[model samples]
Target chain A: MNRIFKQDVDNILKDMYVTSEMKSKIKEKAYSQNNKRIISFSKVAVCVAAIFAFSACVIGATSIFEKVKEKLGNTYETGILKAIPPKENTIYNNISIDTAAAMTDGNSAVAYIVIDDKETVKRIDDTAKISKLNINLVEGNNSMGYTVESVGYDKNKDTVIMKISIDGKNLENKEISLEATDIMSGLESKSYDTKGYKISDIINENATFIEADKGAYNTEEGTIEEYKMLKPDEINIPINNDKTIYISNCAIKDGKLYVQYKYKAEIPNQGSLYFRFNSGLDDYYNMPNVVRNFSVSEKGDICTDDIESKNGWCYIENIFYIDNISQSKDEFLNTTIFTEYDYYKNVVRGNWNISFKVEKLKDVFEGKCNIDINGVNITRYSLSPIGITLRGYSENENVSMYDIDPVVIINGKKIHIYGTSSSEWILDEYKNMEENIVFKYSFSNVTNISNAEKIILGDKEIIVEKN
Target chain B: MGVNIVQQEYENYEIHLDELMDKYGNSILRLCYMYLNDYNLAEDAVQDTFINVYRSMHTFRNECNEKTWITKIAINVCKSYMRKSWFKRIFTTDTLKEEGYNYNFNTNIDRENIVGEIMKLPQKYKEVILLYYYYELKIPEISQVLGIPSGTASIRLKRGRERLKETLEDWYYE
Candidate 1:
C-alpha cells in the first residue's frame, strides 16, 4: 500500500520542476539582500570596518551611554565632546528607534540615532535605509540642511546606526522632531554585457536608426552637457529588455558614440543605467569622458497612481567622444552597461517618530576673516571640536570651492581638512558662477580647535580671530 | 578590497543555492504538493523554502544530515503557510482535485485512490505518512522535520497507514 501511495505521489510530482524564471528571481533577491551593505564597501573600506566594529559594540551595549559613546567614536573617550542623553525605547511596527547621542557647539549639531528591529527573524537587512524622512523644529521656522548617514548594521542585534548632522541656526534650546515613514532595503547593481555583438554589425544588419533627441555632443567645443531637439526622422536607436532599466538605444555619428538608456522613474523600484566603453588597454579610468543629457518632457506628464504607466519612462543618454570609432569598434562592442537598481525587498511601514531637545556646548569658535588667496576670498569660518565650516567664494569662474583645501595649523602642526559639504555655486544663465561658491569643511577627527593659531586657506594663511 | 571578498562570497552562495535547488527542488515541490494539497501553493512553498534556506544558510550547523536539515526547513515553511487564515478560507478539496487533475497523472485507479485517501487523513498523520512513504524518510528524520518525538512519528505513521487501508479496504486487503 505504501509502495502504491509513493508511486502515485511521485507520478503527480514528476512533472513539477522549479522554472528558470523562478530561480532567477530567487537568485536576484538573495544577491540584493546580501550585497546591499557592500554598495559603499569599495569607496570606504576602512569606514565599513569601523561601522562593523561599532555595531559589534552596540550588540553588547546595556546602557544608552555606552551606545552613545560608540557612535560618537573615541572623541567621547578623550573628553572633547559631551554626549546628550537621548529619549529611548520608542517602539513601532516591531522596530525600536532611539536617539543615541547628540552634541552641538551652537553653530553645528550632530545626532546619532539607532534603529533596532525586535524580531526573531530580522527585516533590517544590510541595505536597509530610511525613506520619506522629515526633520524639523517643533516650534520655530525650521530651515535646516541635514545629512543623514547610515553608519552600519549589526546582523546579530538587528540594529542600524544613523548619524544626522545639521547646521545649527536657532537650533539650541528647541525641540527637534524626526519622522521616517518607510525603511527601504535590498539595492542591487546589475550589469548587462553585450559581448560578441559588434555595434556596427548590429546597426548594419538591422539598418534601423533614429536621430537622438538628446545627448548629442560637439567634440570641438568640448561641451558635453548640451541639449538638442531631435530633427525629423532622427537616428535614435532603441534597445528593449525585461528589466527596469536597459540600454534603449545606441549609434555612432560625428566621431561620437551615443548610448541612450530608458529608465522607469517615480516607481517603487527605481533604477538608472550607464554605459562605459574602454579601449581594453587600461581600466575604464583611462576612457574618454562621457557627455550626457536627458529629454525634457513635452507634455510635462507626471506619474499616475498606476505603477505600470508609460508616463514614467525617462530617457537619459551618454555620449562618448571616441577618437575614431571605426578603429575602436571592438572596444565599443566590449562596453558594459551597468544598471544601478534600488529596490525595497522588505519595507517596514510605521511612524518611526522621535523628538528631542537640542543641547548646546560652550566650547565653540565662531569668527569672520578677510583673507584672499589665488583670487579666492575667505570671508567667515567656524571651528568646533567636532567639525569646521568655512564660507568663501571666487569670482574667477574657474575656481570652485572644491579647489580650496584648507589646512588648519593647530599647536604648531598643520592638519589637512576634508570637505564634508558645500553650497551650490551661484551660477548665472550661462552656467558660470555669478557669486561666491560657499563651502563647509568637516574633519573626521575631533580636533582641539581652541589651541589653533591660524587656518591656511588656499595658499594664504589668516590668523584665527574671535568674533 | 572588501568588495572582492563580498563578491567571492556572493558567488559561492549562488553556487551553493544552485546546487541545493538542483538536488532538492523537485523533491521539495513534491513534498509541499502532498502537504498543501494544491499545486500552486506547493510551488510557492518550494520558492519560499529555498529562499529561507538561502537566507539562513549561516545558521545551519551540520548537526544532522544536510538533507534532513533542508527537509526540516521546507516542512516548517509549509506549516507556516498552512497557518495563514487565508490558507484555510481559500483552500478546498474541489480546488485540489481540479489543480491535481491538471498535472495529468496517468496512474492505476487503485494507486490513485490510495494517494487520495492518504491525503484525506488528518494533518498530524498525513505529514508523517507522506514523509515516510513518499519522501522515504526514516522515523527519526521525520521526527526532526515534524518537530515530534520518534515514538509519535511512528504512531502517526502506523495509524495513517491503517486509516488509508480502511478507506481503500478492497485494494489494501487484496
Candidate 2:
C-alpha cells in the first residue's frame, strides 16, 4: 500500500528511538523556563535559498547540524550559489569544473563542477549517499591524500559542488586538476557518534576510538630527556577550603611532566590546564601548542600493552622514540613549569608555582569489573583515575548490536563513558576470525569506582563483580 | 527506594513527559523533518515543541486537539528556526573550496518514500499535504492548525493533489 508517502519511510519514522533518557531530558528542560531561541526566517531570506541549494547536502550530518536546520528553509541550489558568487567558472568534457578560484581554506578544497543539475538533484532524492566524483588533488609531481567531504548541487547553474579535504598538515596548493572520470557514488560509512548513542552505549561496539593528532610529539634532541623525580615533600600550597591537589608522585621524563596527586574536594571539579613548555628558549614564544599529544594515567594504566602514543605523552613502560632527550642542564632548569587547577566560576585560577615542587602524582589505582553481556564475556578490564577500559572476545569476526550500551550503573544512576584507546575495531561481518577487543573510555566526575553495580548493554546486564 | 516529596512531584512531570513523547513524539519529529529537511534540526525543533507544550500545559484548555496543538507548535518552532542568517554564511559558495567538513542533507527515505516525494513538492504544497494526509486531519482541523480558513485549506488540498498527480501520475494511475 504505497500512498503519496511510502510505507517504509513511515516505518522508519515510527522506529526513531524515543529514549527514556530523552524523556527525562524533556521533563527537566520543560520545567525549567530558559529557552533562548534562533534567528528568524525573514531577516535571512538568503538562507532559504541556501536551504534549497543545500537540500542534497542535508542528508549528511543531519544529527549533528539539527540545531541550525531552520535556516535550511524552502529553496533551490541556484539561489544559493549565485548568493556566494563563484570564481573561475571552468568546464570539463560534459562535466564542467565551474569554479575553483572562488574558495580557499588551508584544510579543505571546494570545486563547483557543472553537470546536469536536474538529474543530480533528482538523483539526490533517489540515492542514500552522494556519489563521490573521481577527482584528485595532485601536487607538481605527487598525488595528495584527500576525500570528497561534501557534494551539493546548484539547479540554476547545473553544477555539482564538490568539497574535499586534503590529508596531512599542509593545504597550500594553487592550481590543481579536477579529474572527472566517472560519476563516482555510493560509499556508505557507519558513523560511531556518541551524541546519537544513549548514555548506556559507552560500551557499544559502535564505540569506536576517536583518532586525533597526539599533538607536536617529536623526539627531543638529546640522549636522555630531562627526567626528574620529585621526592615526597610538603611544599607550601595556597590552600583553598574547597580544593587541594596534594602531590604524591612527581616526575619529568621523556618530554612529559607527570604529576600524580590526590585531589580532595568539597565540590566536584572539571577543569583543564593552559601551560607553556619552557624549552630553554630566550623568551616565551608560542610553540605549536601540542597538548593533545600529552596523555595521562592518573590512576591505573591508561596505556595498555598496545605500544602506542597515549596515556599522557609516553607510556610509563617504554617511552622511547625518535632521537634521545639527553638534555643540557640549561634545558632542564628552564623547564620550571606552571599549572593551575581552577574550579567552577566562583574561584579564580590558582596558578600554583607547581615548580614549588611539593605536590605528588596520585597513586596508580586499578579496578576490574567482570560481567557477562548477552552471554559474551565482556570485561570492564581496568578502571583508572583517567577512565575505564572494556574488553571482550569474539569467536566470530564480529559481535552483534549487543555492544552499544556503554553505561556503568551505580546505585541505579547511569555513568556515561567519555572516549577510549586500544585496538577496538568496528563489528563488521566476518566468519572464523577472532580478536580481543579493548575499549578504554573516559568520563567526568568519576573519582572512585568502588560503588559500580553493573554495566548495562541493552537488556543484558553484566553484574560488575570486582576482582 | 524511598522517594522524597519533591522527587514525587518531579515524577509527575516525568510521567507526563514520557506519555507525551510516546504519544506524538514520532509524528512531530516526522513533521518537523519534513518541514526543515534536516534530521538533527527536526529533532531539536521537536524538543523545543515539547518544552513549549510543558510550558503551556495549563494553557491547553482542551479546545483544540492535543496532537493538532502540538503539531502547530512544531511548525511554528521550525519556522522560527528557519529565520537565522548563519546557514548561508557557513555553507557559502566558498565552502566548495574546503574539504573534510561536510553534512549530507538527504532523507533516509528517498523519493520512493511518501515523505520523500512530499518533500520534493514546492513549499506551498507541503503544509497542506502533511496535515491533510500524514496527520490525518479533516480539512477544518487542518485549517485550524494552519490558522487559515477551511476554504483555503480545501483549495490548497486540491492544488496540492493536482501537483502531486502531475509528479506522481504513474503511481496515481496505478
Candidate 3:
C-alpha cells in the first residue's frame, strides 16, 4: 500500500492533463485580434514585396543606381556631425583678505577650528594668515575654521568673544558677546564679460583682488563700510609692480557679466598679451590666443586669426587685413594685436595678425591651429593650389583620398582641419603651436631625367635640375 | 516559379499551426496549472505562450523540436506571471488554501494530506518532480526546458524523491 501510494503521488505530480475546453480557450486567446493583426501585417509586407518585384520585372529593368540607392538606404547610418549652438561667457573673480593681519589691528581675529561634534567640546586648531586656508577634513569628523569668530564694540569685549570655545559650552570671564557693529567684513569677487570670450578663455590665475576696511579707530561704535570691499574693474599693473593679485577657487560657465572698461590707446599691433592672474603663490595667465578660433562652420571653414588684448600694446604690422565682411545677426567681429613691450611702451618683437569671422559674441575664443610644413601635391582636377591628392598602392583598391588628411592651406600657411586622418608621411606635433609636415610633389610633362635628386623628409634637401 | 513556391509554404504553415495546437495545448495548460496552482491563471498563461510563439514564428530557427519550443514558451509565461506584483497579493496562503483543489483519492489516506505533504517541499525540488513525474518528461528533456544541465536535473529529481519518502515516513511514524 505504501509503494502504491508513492507511485500515485509521482503520477499525480508528473502527468499534466488539460481538457478540450481549456485547449479551445487557449486557441481562442492566441488568435485574438491583436495577434492576428501582427501576423497579417507581416504577410502583407511579404506580398507587397513579391508583387512589386514582379511588376518591376514586367515593366523594365531597374537601374543599378536605384538598386544601389535602395541598398544604401537600407544600411544603418549614424554619427552625424551635430552643430552645437555657441554660448555666452561668464567670469567669476576671487577676492582675498589678510585676515591674520586684520585681526592683529584689533578689528578681527582669524581662528581655524575643526568641530569633531557640534554637541562636544573637541576641535582641530590651525592658524591661517590669509582669509582662505586649505583644510583637509579627516573622515567621520566635522571640521571648519572661521577667519573672524566674533567681534565686539569694546576692545576688551572683543578678546572674550574670540577666546570662547566653538562647542558653545564654558564661556571665559574675559570673553565678551558679539555686537553687530564688531562683525568684520571684507570683499572677494572677480568678473569678466561674455561679449567676446568663449567659456574656456577666462583665466583663473591671479584673478583675485582684496580690499580691507579703512577706519582704524575713533568710531568705537563700530563702522559700516560703503564700497569698502571693492574689486577693481581694471587689472592694470606696472611691469615691475611687486604686488601680485592671487585668484583661487574660480569657475567659468555660460552666462553674462557687466564689462565696463576703456581700451588703453598704447596697445600694440602684434605679438601676444598675457593677463597675469595671481592665484596664491603661483601666478596664472589666460592664454587667450590658444583658445580663440576653436570651432569651425558647417561648410568646414574656420578663421585663422588670433584675438588680441584690447588694453595692452602689441605689434600692429603682423595683423591680418580683413578683405571681406560676412556678418550674421548673432555674430560679432573681434580683433586684437599683441605688442613686444617692456613696460607697456617699449617695443621688441615682430607681430602676427589673425582675422576670422565668428557667429557668436564671445569675449574669448578657445581656438587651436594645425600647420602642415610638408609640401602638398596638386592634382590636375584641383580648384586651389592647396588641393592635393595622395594615392595609396593597389593591394588596397579604391581608397578615397579625403580620408588621408584634412589640413587646408590658406595662401601658403597651414590651418585648422577637422575630421580627417593625417597620412603616415606627415609628421604632426602640438607645442605652443600644432605643426604638420606635408610632402610637396610636382609631376613633370617630359620624360624622366636621370639627374633628378629625390626629396628626403625632415633632413634631406631636394635637388631640382633642368632636363 | 518563386510565387508558386511561396504560396505553398504559407499553406504548410497554416496546417502546422493546427496540428501543433491539437497535440500540445493540453500539456502546456497543465504545466502552467501546476506552476501557478491556479486554473484560470494557468489557462491565461498557456494562451499567452501560444500567441508569442505565433508572432515570433518567423525568427524561430529549427534548432530544437516543436515540443521543446512550446514548453519553453509556457515556462517563460508562468515565470513572468509570478513576477507581477499583483499576482503575489492575490495568491496569499490563506487565499490559496481556500481555493486549492483537493485530489479526491478513494483510500484510507486523505488526498488533502498528500497534497499538503507535496506543497511542503522546497519550490525548486517540487517543480522538478512535478515536471518529471507528472509531465512524464525525461530528465534530459526537463533540463532543456528549465535551461539547466542534465546532471542538475537528475540531482533535483533524486533530492525530491528522498524528501517525499521522508515526509511519508514521518507521517506514518506519527
Q: Name the candidate that leads on TM-score.
A: 1
How much of the true contact map at the interface does candidate 3 reproduce, as a fraction? 0.16
Q: What is the lDDT of residue A312 in candidate 1?
A: 52
Q: Which candidate is the best by lDDT?
A: 1
Q: Docking category for candidate 1?
A: incorrect
lDDT of 2 at B72: 73
| lDDT score for candidate 2 against the true structure | 0.40
Native-interface RMSD of candidate 1: 28.6
Scored by lDDT, model 1 comes in at: 0.57
lDDT of each: 0.57, 0.40, 0.31
* Per-residue accuracy of model 1 over A1-467 as CA lDDT, tens digit each: 55765676677444556656456555765666544432111111123433544444534675655655655555566576766666646788889888877767665677777788889876886667675567777787464556566665667878777777665554676778777766766555443344423455434323234434344444323353434322211233333334545455556656666555555554332444444333332112111244343433446432212223245555544555544222355555664432323334456777777877777655567677777654566677777766666556676443433334567887899876533434434445335442354455555434557677887765667777644
User: lDDT tens string, model 3, A240-327?
Assistant: 2221121111222122111111122222221122232222221111111111111122343322222233323211111111111112
Pick the winner on lDDT between candidates 1 and 2. 1
Cα deviation of A192, candidate 3, in Å: 53
Where does the lowest 10-residue lDDT sum fall in candidate 2 chain A?
A352-361
* Per-residue alpha-carbon lDDT of candidate 2 for residues A46-158, written as tens digits (9 for 90 to 100): 22222233545422222211212222222111122111223333333333333322122222232323333233333221111222223334445334433442234433434
